[model samples]
Target: MEPPELRRAVAAGRVAASELGLQVDDVVVVHNSDRVALRLVPCDVLARVAPVGHLADSEFEVEVARRLNAVDAPVAELDPRVEPRVFLRDAFAISLWTYYEPAESEIAPTDCADAFLRLHAALRHIDLEAPHFTDRVAVALGEVNDRERSPDLPESDRELLSGTLSGLSATISTEHDRDQLLHGEPHPGNLLNTRRGLLFVDLATCCRGPIEFDLAHAPEEVGDHYKGADPVLIHRCRALNWAMFSAWRWRRADQMPDRDRWRATGLDNVRAALDRCHLD
Candidate 1:
């Protein structure tokens, strides 16, 4: 959705929440992309609104977070008063979560590693159906191939992206590495260092994949703290993540707040990944 449309949808979501008895005094946008995150004050709720088609994914995230909370895992929790259900308003789907105050200092690598181990243990026991991590790669591959949709991407870069994705997809598919429930994007940005402890916020991207996939987004020092994690697989997953994000940025550059900067950085990301994987 366009920026104007997104803002309107989020505003509508806030209004819907108000109707539902949420005391929302102010709405501060935490992030905006395929999903819009609003920090609702007074009542202290975080509203996540995505496109209608993403209702299932949003609901799934709430369910996953609630279940993880049940097991005393370090994860963001949903609002207890409101039942976990998708709130449809306008063209968006919204879900409410209990908001946490950000910690004054960033969480250390060791803290992140320890928290992830606990979260991973809880996630593995979840029986809900989830897509493989590579399925997202497949979607990115499709977007990169849509020249009409991503007209800004040069033909040279397009060919490079296609070839790079194909190789990574094959490698990811045939790897003998053990698979497990992954946080999907366990980078520091998604992690909140609350007063309670380190809690993960974005659950929409959770999926079944190698633990190394989760570590790929973390700092190398953080990966080192994760005992028994394969360094080689972590290296490969890092490359895969770059490829995925590169394709996504290339596809959505026009809608981005800083299109030129994103494109330049995304091109660099793709080039670096290819060189690292020896695919260049």
Candidate 2:
């Protein structure tokens, strides 16, 4: 009835269907495209497909993750392992590394802090290098301005996008200029909880950058709206950073009037975050 959906039934299990060659009657629709995750019932092995455009990056990330998390690594030694590894794909923005696996978890406060340190530590030692991440961010920024290309966006949003980029360029140029190995996009969704402490998946945006750029989003800032495996407080300073970052992003995406966009959605999200624990 329309253009193809991306990774619609990815890690939710359809790929498992292919690998298992399950009987035709066994497949169930767990999710639809451009929406929440799906649940494919009665599936033993969960298999997922990478988003079509993200195919290359997703594949690259999986390879890097497998290599970085290889047998000899301390992350593996310290973390739990699953037999016959399985990962799931869920369209353009998300990918499931693995799930519900268990591990000796860290204390609440130190969870993300320790995880960030550990992630950077592992990244520092990994032999594999993921470059194009810079190019990806650039492209994604351009997409924010590409209204005609985005059916969900309007013309006003396109213009607002232009302004946001200008602001982002200035702020990031002066602020996030440091070069450190980072998880790239370390939002809450990127971190997974397996038996072994917390395992990070979704390295699509992984790259070299100011460690703050990644750590800034920590469980508190990025996942402020919801609960995650990591314990967190509503730290406004960092939370504001993420809020502005996103407002500028949406400002570019919807091309809304400059002030209204941020004040309404962007600042609002930030405010919600700031009010979360009311640190001040």
Candidate 3:
């Protein structure tokens, strides 16, 4: 039951690879969600395919990866056989990256933290144009405020999400002096345990923010392992993250699996996080 977009994406990815003179006989879907990621068969290259409108975002990810690779950051590398740039074909944007075989062992919390620390350390010295974390909050807020985007969301829930996003964004912005380049979402799903060690993928969400903001996306235990992270700021950022995720889940266009369950869970997490914040 592949979505129509996924079918188109697979075709676009294969065509893009062939145009680059690479022989891709089959395409294996590595991941499919908001975007489609295909592994070009026989070639062992990962091709991330999205709509044409995401061309700029894909290009941004390629540039970010290039810079991070130069600094030897713990991030995935762009495919070397092809030009290190995005390819557009059949109304989709495609970017090729090195395919890493997954390691059997799960990444420990300490290992995840160490990877994040290394990534952040490298990111600190690299200069790149990226949005601030508040911009992401604003996008979520826009989704909450737009009835068409979240038609199924109750008014009360909408108000709660809007308030949480706005309040936390303002509070977080006040600490902009501590801001630095951050992996906007370092959650477990974005971390890959490979023979090369824990390498991060999906760099499109990179932004300028406090390190606490990135830690909020990781496991709670990870924060304890990351030195110098402010617990209070992490808590607030966690709540904000939940709100943003909830807003995304509520969107009519969101195609995440088990949307109803994730939407409910996200809302519940946001409420619980808010309660804990209030109690503290």
Candidate 4:
């Protein structure tokens, strides 16, 4: 979103929060991409603002959080001050969450693995209907295949991404017996080091897939600590993850920070992963 649109979204979030009887003295942007996350001051509530069209996705995230909280899973919780639901204001979809103060120390790989294991255990009991991991791959595949959507992507690069996504998706799809709800993108960025501990956020990407698919998003060393993880499957999923991210970065409408740098890095990672797989 442009600066003006982002300002409008923040304003919308502030209005929504105020309506919930929270006193907001100031607003601080937590992050900005396709959506904006703002920290409402004094109240210490985090408000996630996205285009109103994303209402369904926001609603899904809230539901996922509620279920996770119910099972005492290590995930961010919705704000107790407001109804646990998506609030629409102006042209933005706003959702309030409890904001955790950041911890001074970073989460260690082993700790991350342990938290992820506990999360997976709790997720096993969740019965929510979610998209399959292939559905996510298809979305990226669609972007790469659409020339207009990825106008800046070179034809050769597009082909590389397309092939990688297709092959890995097919290979991973065969593991239906191991299919279960996954945190979709459990990378370091999504894991918050908070006062409570390392709690995972961004539940919007929740999907059904093999555990290795989720592990692929974490640091390589994390898989070492996560016992029973299939190394080969994790490697394959890592390639797929890179390809998907590369596709997203190439989108003509993507506004992620440092997108160009990430696009180049993603392509490199994908190629490197593929080469390693070939050697193995």
Predicted structure with the largest lDDT when compared to the true one:
4
Question: How well does candidate 2 match the true structure in TM-score terms?
Answer: 0.58
Candidate 1 weakest ten by summed lDDT: 251-260
Superposed on all Cα atoms, the candidates' RMSDs to the truth, in angstroms, are 1.8, 8.1, 1.5, 1.2
- Candidate 4 off by > 4 Å: none
Please say which candidate is ahead in TM-score: 3 or 4.
Answer: 4
Instruction: Put the candidates in TM-score order, highest first.
Output: 4, 3, 1, 2
How many Å off is the CA of 121 in candidate 2? 0.8
Q: Which stretches of candidate 2 lie over 4 Å from their true place?
A: 1-46, 71-98, 101-107, 132-134, 151-160, 174-177, 221-267, 270-280
Residue range 1-280, candidate 4, lDDT tens digits: 7899999998999999999899999999999999989999999999999998899999999999999999999999999988999998998999999999999997788999999999999999889999999999999999999999999999999989999999889988986459899999998889999999989999999999999999999999899999999988899999999999999999999999999999999999999999867822
Worst 10 residues of 4 by lDDT: 271-280
- Candidate 1 residues lying further than 4 Å off, grouped into runs, are 1-3, 252-254
Instruction: Write the residue-wise lDDT of candidate 3 on 1-280 in tens digits.
Output: 1578788899899988988888899999888877888999888889999888888999999999999999999999999888899888988889999999999997788998999999999999899999999998999999999999899999999999999999989988896569999989888888999999999999999999999999999989999999998988899999999999999999988888888999999999999998878822
Better candidate number, 2 or 4, judged by lDDT? 4
For candidate 3, report its TM-score.
Answer: 0.96
Q: What would the TM-score be for candidate 4 when compared with the true structure?
A: 0.98
Candidate 4: what lDDT? 0.93
- Give each model a TM-score: 0.93, 0.58, 0.96, 0.98
Candidate 3, position 93, lDDT: 85
